[model samples]
Target: MDTLTLQSTIRMNNGVEIPRFGLGTFQSKAGEETYNAVRWALEMGYRHIDTAALYGNEEDVGRAIADSGIPREEIFLVTKVWNDDQGYESTLRALEASLRHLKTDYVDLYLIHWPVKGLRHETWKAMVEIYKQGKARAVGVSNYTIRHLEELLSNTELVPAANQIEFSPFLYRKALLEYCVQHGIVVEAYSPLARAQKLEDPRLTAMAQKYGKTPAQIALRWALQHDLVVIPKSVRKERILENASIFDFELSAEDMAEMDTWNEDYWTISESYNPECSPRWE
Candidate 1:
């Protein structure tokens, strides 16, 4: 298989280069916890960092980025707007708020956190406007299903450049991934290590043993081998460094195939698209 690096990038539908490995700020609460994790990740060579308005850590993330001294252009900054901010006006205001909190004038990628029922079109319109205004280099969505993708494709002139979803070996989205490949949208795995749940999986553990790496590394390698972007979060400095070290080793095709056959039930997080989820569009 081809190799990957912290410097490697996946092109978006809009033709922007996004780092293959990103630092996830999900659940990274505000204050020193998030500020420290982001600082450590950047110090350890992570150029891509993902955050959302709902994470409530944008200010902390902004602090880390400001202090890291890494050139803003060298790092790929991506953040999303939550469902509550799903209207054209709300999205516009939210983007400005995110920018203020992140302490950056432009984000590398701005995404619609989820596809809401009545206001997704309006939300998307605002996102396209953000992109045109140079506030966001590219715009996309998260937790969007194929059905949701089709809606945007058929109804709008602007196409999403990427889709952020909970993807890992336990939740291999083969069908949606195939569709994305055919449609020019890049699929980014948010909970790439299943939020570190696969730290004890037999298949992952065995592969880690064979490679003398951590189970997390094996899982991340599985995603990288498929050419998908993987954002794994960790507050521990060592773990942050370990996750970025995935580029040094390659998982064999045989092992990759075996891991693929492990199972296909990995969406532990309930998304807005879940029919069971009562609409939370505010």
Candidate 2:
């Protein structure tokens, strides 16, 4: 297979194209920090920027995009509506706020940030309307488990253009990935580095030594080779550059198979992070 580059794109079900690699602004602060990080990522050749209303960094993200001198069309800007904003009229209002904060007339992609139980399908209905109005080039979801996706597919008219999930070799959701692929939905891997928690695993360490690359790069390459769009988050200049370097290398089938064995369905537990509460996994 040919080596993938930073500029490689995958077309969504809506015919909107998204970059295969992107910089994620999750915990990035909404000021000079977020602004500088985004500016640096764009300067370093990143064409995709993923942020959300929950991140509280939309204003800075928008500022960086405006100052970058790159035309808005050239960048695939993605943002999401938070769980609290997940109802019919509320979602429409949220998208307008996101666009206002993003300082753009339209967003490349808009997502329902999480599957908030009774609100999931209803939120999707509103998103579909937003798509119809061309406010969002494409609409999708994040943190949706397979059961949640099934419920959504059964009710919604338009299939989601993509599904963003927490994916890495350690937390690999193979079955969910397969299901999305079968249904013509692009699977985007957020937190693709596993929050840098398992980067020092013996296997990843060995691969890093053998390949002369960092363990994080090995992890990102694993996600990309699985045909998943990867949005690895980092605010540091060097780490951002390191994450972007994975495109030059391709993992072999044998190596990928070995990486598959690393899966433990690991979940990052935090006092504030509740997947069941927010995403409602089955």
Candidate 3:
């Protein structure tokens, strides 16, 4: 078994260390299913896990973390406040709820799940407060477009430690990537495999053939090459292990150029992010 090496870790703005590769528990079912997924992921040597309140699987994730017997400090647990929970008071309560559900006193990273209409600034304020109070080690956002990030910078004191977005070769975000690099925000690729659509992509396959690795691994390597934290998810044990096997080979610059050119108007998620929202999270 190839252990995920520490040579790949990325240091965030807040001095919080994050593993470049991790398991993403988005939309994983609740109860036993999520618990099993988290346990399996940890058993397979995943040290970071990303989840959100809207997914409703925090308790299951927490249970697995607890049972894994991995000390709380060893795991990089991340959760977010949902759209409805965007106000200062609501975000505070929401963080508490996520903590209780995850069975932890604090999470490594807490994020705003989305930038809904009208409430992102206030939510950011609340997040800063939480960070200031030492409730969360770092604060960040997900699905925040560049416009949203610019507005956040204009309004808030804390620069986000990360921005987990849907990034793959097919949806390459060159400008946003540069912006994040300039701003000190680590760009995290949530759908690095493009929801598994890129598994059979010819460009990726050709590179995989050349490198003798899977297309999934090629996709991850591409993201990592750009210094993005890539979270490729899987419930199957073989896949869980396979996703972490990108450390052995490096994608060549010519192949990286070809893979990078694969981007042509593709995005997996809908529901455009508007930073305005009604004050409540349910």
Superposition-based RMSD of candidate 2 using all C-alpha atoms, in angstroms: 1.7
Query: How do the residues 125-227 of candidate 3 rate in per-residue lDDT, one tens digit apiece?
Result: 9999999988899999987778889988998778999998888999888998899999999999988888897588777788889899998988888888888
Q: What's the lDDT for residue 86 in model 1?
A: 86
True-structure lDDT of candidate 1: 0.88
Model 2 lDDT tens row, 223-257: 98998999998999999999999877778899999
Which digits, one per residue and each the tens of the lDDT, describe model 1 over residues 43-99? Answer: 888999999999999999989999999988988999999989889999999999999
Compared with the true structure, model 3 gives a TM-score of: 0.93
After TM-score superposition, the amount by which residue 8's alpha carbon in candidate 2 deviates from its true location, in angstroms, is 0.2
Report the error of model 1 at residue 34, Å: 0.9
Put the candidates in lDDT order, highest first: 2, 1, 3
Q: What is the C-alpha lDDT of each candidate?
A: 0.88, 0.90, 0.85
In model 1, what are the clashing residue pairs, if there are any? none
**Candidate 3: segments with Cα more than 4 A from true spot:** 1-7, 271-282
Error of 2 at 44 (Å): 0.9
Model 3: how far residue 19 lies from native, Å:
0.9
Q: Cα RMSD (Å) per model? A: 2.0, 1.7, 3.6
